[model samples]
Target: MVQHSYAVGMFPATLISLKVKPMNNQEHDEAVLHRLLFQINMEIADQTPKERELFSNSSSHFIGPPQRIAEDNIRLGLMIVLFLAGTPLNVTAMMRLRRSMLSSATPLKQLKQHLNISDLMILLIYTSSQIVWLITVDWRSNDLMCKLLKFSHALCFSVSSNVIVCIAIHRFSMVFGKSTKRVTTVSLWVAWTLAVATSLPQFAVWTVYRPYETATWQQCVSIWFVREYDIRTKNKTLLAEPLISSTAYSVYHVLIVFWIPAALLIICYLRLAMVVSKEIYCECECVKQSQSTPLTNGNMPSTDQHVTSSRRLLSRIISFSSSSSGRFEKALMRHQCVTMRRKRNAIRTCLLLIVAYIFCWLPYNAFFLWGLIDHDSYQQWHNTSIAFLRYLIVVNSVTNPFIYLPNFRSALCSSHAVQS
Candidate 1:
């Protein structure tokens, strides 16, 4: 006899309908199983021990096509590469930032340091977790490990995005010549608070679920639907018991994690570009004027002793004032040059970070939103598209340290030397 029960699955879930009856021979059982497999649209199945064994033995007959296995293998390779590449890069970035902070402690540098830390979390928690996940192809760990890893996964994205937003705001302030230690401190606190609040829901949704008692395959996934018996039909049907509607959850996550931050980044960078352009234009005019100044004659005229003494006396007072004025002007120009260079470097680095963010995450979010709008699109979407987009998200974390640390190293180190 076959059991009737509901099954749950990962994202892009759909309702499943199946009919079951008692069967005597192996051929009859296989026929019924084939029909049930064709009808059920879920990844995990909940059934009795005997039926689960039967399902497991007969599963290969109609499941896990070669293309799906190849996609999984590709995803696994990508994750492993990202994990190995990102770990050392983020660690090196943090170390460099730490050294810079020791020499010259500034709020902007602190924000970047925090950004590196967020990237490290992504590498350490999320990327590595995915590597293991792809290898095992199931939840081999305990319930607590599943919850913690899932929570950390959510936390990594939330914290990294929030920190990037904070960096943009701080850079915007710097360009406008108005940055304060207090504002930076408050902004960081807010970023961390929001990240934690957004990630807390993962604990409620994700768990290690054993779909079959005698089966070793277990999944750590969201339990959005469960199987239940319908009294009228005496058949099992999937019932929704989600913490939040899937569409609503997707909307909230995408908005908080990408859309909102992207909007803010665009506004900040546009204004920043305008201000920097004007400043650079003004500098060009100053350079042209200085370069066009004519050279003075080298010859000197002979004069009498009394005339020379009178001229020399007057010249002493004039020279003193002129020297002081020249020194002050030189100091001012040097300071401005340093400030302008730093601003240009900041713009370059932030632009790279923003571009990388958009490039890496845009397709994934677009796919997610599209899937929410049209469920069939998600179901019919190519597995390669899904795997590639996911790989890109991890690539975002991997590329950040490279985008950030190299550009800032010279500037920060020089600033430190100047301060000393």
Candidate 2:
């Protein structure tokens, strides 16, 4: 009878010792089991065998640590520095170009009045809208703002891309006098229309998602709900489900925004390159004439000095322009160099400016394509790469004017010096 009483006392003592919180499946079952053993060891101080054995032999279960997020934060910091530094350079450069556009005379019958001050304003507004999405939009408290925020983000990216394309096309056409027809006015409308059409799908499909009924917030906004859709088994898409919104987004991006525009831009660039090269040859001729004039006499230099200097200058010019293009008309451009080189110093600065743009922006293009590749390089590259990519995108946008505006400041200063 004493043994039975003692055994009953043991049960209460063991129950009192067990004090553990609930854990995930892999956890020490640290639940009542761990607590019970601990209690037993403490209560039966003299024996102490059972609880020690359980603790010694227990399987360990630890949740993974958060290392990845920490790595990303560091990378993002570096990018922010580069991004900030380049922004003003880009704006100042674009402004220089704007000044040129406004002051420069147009030979065309119907000049584009739409381009005067509006393009810059549009670019500023679009960039500001994107900044709001990247910095402030949180769906938890504001569903409407969130949707509008995402749509604005997509709109800015698409419009900027298309607008750049329009700028490239317009610049190329004006430089070369390719089409006699007044096409710049029509092209602006077309570019905006395409931008809207491309961005519309993102607005149509994106929606705020509430994963937990009591969580008081929605999470995971984007066309890529990859994991969510991967886990989903429902055959039908619902307006209410986040997965459906994501699936539509994935399809839209894959088809409309990325693939189609990439191909079109490539063709546009090719045409532009050809036109620009031809224009360079003409500009080189102009420079050659300018160089032939002696600095003091204002009379043309002797033929021998003219020929030698012209050839050297032309080689420099062709090399500068064709190096980035990789599709230089070598055989054709080679003959032009002799006559062109005498004028080399005239446009040497201009050619170098173009080279800068190609280098800065081309790597960005490669990186952009890499983002779409289904490979581990993108996933495991650490946060550093993503941070770099983010900075690169913003930097490219801002650095463009600075790099591409050939002979911009020098030309202006030279003109002023001449006036003085």
Candidate 3:
């Protein structure tokens, strides 16, 4: 029987590096040999032995395995596609939003402009960094680059999440008839402040280091994982601290970056939908009342009666401005039609954004939490699923610009038509 070793994907823990030779081709099938090799490799990888004699320098050098290099190439191609696709969309969105700002200058428009800016930042910072990182696949830089890159990743997530929440809040206020000028300005400032503050912890957690002194491979990873491996043989029972800390940080990160923002978006959009639906129902009822003709004895009104009713209705409409309160009501009604249309469009656009956000991020965040729950099983399956989840996240950034851009342009055209 021939012996073979297969290195599966990116993570070291998923490496199937052990040579597997079946006892006899007839006695043990290829399936059994592969399964047996997988089990043995997984166990050895988990040990993370510190002794230089345990793992050879060639295998320890963190060079991309055939499978991992292939994956990196695929990832690099996809990143380029995303970057190429997203850059123009975001840039066009920014230009249109800027023009809209000059034309109308609403707070809600300002919030959307900023949201697009944040998405662009994510596309440029996170996606670009990912492309470079995949190309190298090994840490060719110092510790500062490692920490800075991690920090940039965290910063992108936080900023994007917070800006989305801010958009939801601004839209909510707009539909509810609240003044959003000061609110929007303050909320934007707070969003950036919170994002920076939350991401600062990454500087302390990540660093570039080799797995072993004799190993040629260097990686930028959480120090906790490094320390866990370094002291693994010293006290096996003391392993819980680093794992606990890492899990805690993961929980905090997910909450701030995804869970909390998701909750806020759901609540805000649901309330906005309810309020807009109620207003639409009420408007329809008013229109039905106004259009219905008066009837006598369940028969159609005569011409004289119809003429009288028309005269009375016209007189009432004309007299609507007689009092100060009546004038205010007339003024409000004059703008109600336009306001209602604007509100409906806002709700629709925001709903699309919310749906895109949930669809793209739900699995990613779920997998992140699952990894914290079952590290071993997560490591086993993450090699296959992680790339897809990350792609979904990048796709969200690409889709965001398209989501709002068309809606904004249509609204702008409608406004121009109304003016004309």
After superposition, which runs of candidate 1 have C-alpha atoms over 4 Å from their true positions? 1-68, 225-244, 283-334, 374-381, 407-420
Candidate 3 stretches with Cα past 4 Å from truth are: 1-68, 212-217, 232-237, 293-336, 372-380, 407-420
Model 1 C-alpha lDDT per residue in residues 1-420, reported as the tens digit of each score: 444332222222222223354445434333332111111111111111212332332212232211224545665677778889888777777888899899999998899889888888878877666666556566677988866776777778878888888888888887666755877898899999998998777677666655445545666655442222211122222323332364455467677777898898889899889989798778767655544542222112324334765777655655666567557656656776786788788899889889999898788667665654554445456333655665676788888877877654566567669999
- Tell me the whole-model lDDT of each prediction, alpha carbons only: 0.61, 0.39, 0.64
By summed lDDT, the worst window of 10 consecutive residues in model 3 runs over 36-45
Question: How well does candidate 3 score on lDDT at residue 325?
Answer: 45
lDDT tens readout by residue for model 2, 1-420: 000001101100111122233335432232232111111110111111212212221222221211223333443354345445544555555556556667764422122223212233323443343333233222344656645545554555455455454544555565565662456657667866876676565454445544334534343233333232322212222324543443344445433433455555566656655655676678677656544532332232334455775877755555555454333344334556753552343233233323433443344334434433432343335223433433343454554443345564586567669999
For 10-62, candidate 3 gives per-residue lDDT tens digits of: 11112222233334423424342222111111011112221112222322224
Candidate 2: residue 358 lDDT (0-100): 43
Predict model 3's lDDT versus the native.
Answer: 0.64
Q: RMSD to the native, candidate 3? A: 9.2
Pick by lDDT: which candidate is best? 3
- Backbone clashes in model 2, listed as residue pairs: 18-35, 90-398, 309-342, 310-341, 310-342, 311-338, 313-341, 314-341
TM-score of each: 0.72, 0.50, 0.72
Prediction RMSDs, each to the true structure: 8.6, 19.5, 9.2
Least well predicted 10-residue stretch by lDDT in candidate 2: 1-10
TM-score, candidate number 1: 0.72
Model 2 stretches with alpha carbons more than 4 Å out? 1-83, 90-102, 105-141, 171-181, 223-262, 269-378, 382-384, 406-420
